[model samples]
Target: MNLKNKIVIITGAGSGIGAATAKLFGTHGAVVVASDINLNNAQKIAGDITEAGGIASAIKTDVTQYQEVEALIANTIEKHDRLDVIVNNAGIGGKEQLKTAEHTHDDWHNVIAVNQTGVFYCMKVALQHMMRQGHGNIVNVASLAGLKASGHNLSYSASKFAVVGMTKSAALEYARKNIRINAVCPGFTHSALLDQLLAVSPDMGEKLKRFIPMGRFGEADEIAEAICWLASENSKFITGQTITLDGGTSL
Candidate 1:
């Protein structure tokens, strides 16, 4: 994919699929803006890209905060002169394995804030700049739960389902303006978020793996590849679509 000189902003880029996508985009000649809740981790990823002879910068952003999200876009535009693409990859999982009745209000609101509302904030800000530019791309990191009923976590599922809906609605609204919006629904991927779950239930990984026909957990890089494609012109005709990379588990 030809992403040369494309200014791309990736949220939650400190680790997991976000970090992997930053590195991949850098290698493909995109100027990567790595944004995360943790400044240190974002700096490390940005530094790694720079060390590899690619251009990148780090910004600390809490996507759950609209002001912070606004600053992230404004600062990127101020430095780069134009915004090309935004990967709404920042997200959080709620209390896992909890029944609907067992899920707390705080957990639901917190998950919705980061996963759903946060995406809206990023999209809202980026859309303004992108609309003026008359061209842009938006790649949202949703989850398998978003595409189907995942009894794992009520709040997480609800929030992600909202992402899917938002992506499609926004894509149709912006298609004529030369902007594309899409999402990726990854299933059973090995990410820091998943590691946290494993920390709590060590055998969960093996149990989840058994459901996948591939019999292995996905690597972050695997998901990154798809994100890079969606951000590139290679997928110019594709929008309002959720690409699933679950190793046949969804089947």
Candidate 2:
């Protein structure tokens, strides 16, 4: 688990699980490149890491834009000279914006653009770099919605399902090339996304926890731990798999 001097690029690093993961990786001695559409938030997170004596840099990234994603990857490589880990965690929970089939086109399109296409773009760029390095780790942050149906969450589920599919395919294609790809499917994690979902269905949050049997929502750190492990050599033998950190909710 010693990631000293490792170069890592994390998307959606502005807030929520992505932010937590970025900080965790940085704290573990990884030189982290934290990217987010919100440049301010990204800068703040990177600043905090630096203040704590962790190596980190911030960059503005619109994951849906291939050019932006490519630039982010290129910048990371330019600054660090090599990329060791890529965490494609940039995504949106459309549980609030995308309510039904008849929802606004803008809402639906935005979710798909950010959640699905963004992941694809990140993987493509990261893989290109990793292929040259002959070794890399890719961890895509998917969701339980990718595995099960979550009503009123059309765009979010669709995007996550696509991510799961892409992760599996990429993993198989790169297994022999020394590149590992995996997905972490979290359920009912505490974040802005969850807050939006809860706002829509106040009691649903409590009900959702009941289904987990653990009777509680998960912490962002819980998911971050999974990402960190998957990104490490400890998971060298693991790939093309989706690890669920939902306190047995999917069971």
Candidate 3:
């Protein structure tokens, strides 16, 4: 889709799906703000976009902290003078979660802080601006685990479920404000982190694939495409929806 001159802020844009989405948006003529806790990586992405004749900038932000996220939006507006899109893509799956009785409390807190609270912060701040401007697009990156219970990753599942719920509730509240809100729930996808895991245990990657109806992991760019469509004018009528791109894993 043509995103000519649209101003987009993407959190966790240093790597994985966030990076892919930022690059894709830049390719389509959007001015991209690539924010991540890892400043160096974010800078690398921004540099890549600049080299390719796209407008972009890197900003260090820890979405888990409200002040940092607020500053991110402030800086974006100060530089761009407007916010067209905010992608709440900063999230964490945490270390493997045990059963209710065995799970560490810190793991639950950490996961919820980043995945749930962080999304809330981004949405709250962006809405204040979007409401005044009379239009915007907000896309929160949820997960297949959000739609279903993950016995082994309870904290991650809980955090993402909250994201889906937030997306729906917020979307309803702002449906008529010309601001569209939605969530993208993806299944097991290939990424740098997944690469590290597969490198350590190659067989586990193949084994996990059997459970997906598509018999393979979805690509990061595929998920980015869904996000782009939802943010584009083509899907202006699509709000308050959870678009699942999980290779039918939820089915």
Candidate 4:
């Protein structure tokens, strides 16, 4: 991937896919701004990259807050003088598996706030800068649930569906402006998010793996590779598409 010297921001970068992507971006010679709600984790990732001879920094951002999202973009631009790519990878799953009728309002709101609304905030703020700069790329981290039906998590499904929708819509709106927007829909990836799911239903991992044609969970670095490609010039002509990395489970 030709991400050399690109100034990139990744949300939810404290761990999992976000952390993997940040490190990958660093390796590709991009200036990585690892943003997360957890400042310590973000700092650690940044520190590791710096130690490895890559340029990186950590920014504490709660994506659910618009002001904080704005500050993230503003600070990056103020320091880097240009915003190249932003990976809206921050998201949360439902607390428990429940059917629509049995889903609690609080869980629904919280999930939506982080997954959908938070993505919107990042895009809205980043777009302003990109539009002014007349060039940029966006890679949103949606899920396979966003592409297909999720059995029991209505909020997560709905919010990710919104992300897919927003990615395509914005891609079209900004296509002529030299801005590209795309998404990666990962299925059953081995990340903290999946661990949380498995923690809730300890026996579900094997059952879920059985459905995948590959018969294994995806590694976070695998998804990061795709994200880096999408953000790089190699995929410059691609936009408004959701690349699925699900071990063929969605097939």
Every candidate's lDDT: 0.95, 0.90, 0.90, 0.96
Q: Determine which window of 10 residues in candidate 3 has minimal summed lDDT.
A: 193-202
Candidate 3: lDDT of 21? 94
| Model 4 agreement with the true structure over 104-211: per-residue lDDT tens digits | 999899999999999999999999999999899999999999999998899999999999999999999999999999999999998877888888666889988898
* Model 3 clashing residue pairs (backbone): none
Candidate No. with top TM-score:
4
Error of 3 at 29 (Å): 0.2
Q: Which ten residues in a row have the lowest lDDT in candidate 4?
A: 193-202
Model 4 alpha-carbon drift over 4 Å, by segment: none
lDDT of 3 by residue, 72-125 (tens): 999999999999999999877656536778888888999899999999999999
lDDT (Cα) of model 1: 0.95
How big is the positional error of residue 51 in model 1, measured in Å on the Cα after superposition? 0.1
RMSD to truth, every model: 0.9, 1.4, 1.4, 0.7
In model 1, how large is the Cα lDDT of residue 232?
A: 94
TM-score of each: 0.98, 0.96, 0.96, 0.99
Which candidate gets the maximum lDDT versus the true structure?
Answer: 4
How close to the true structure is residue 40 of candidate 4, measured as C-alpha lDDT?
Answer: 100
Candidate 2: C-alpha RMSD to true structure equals 1.4
TM-score of 4: 0.99
Clashes of each: 0, 0, 0, 0
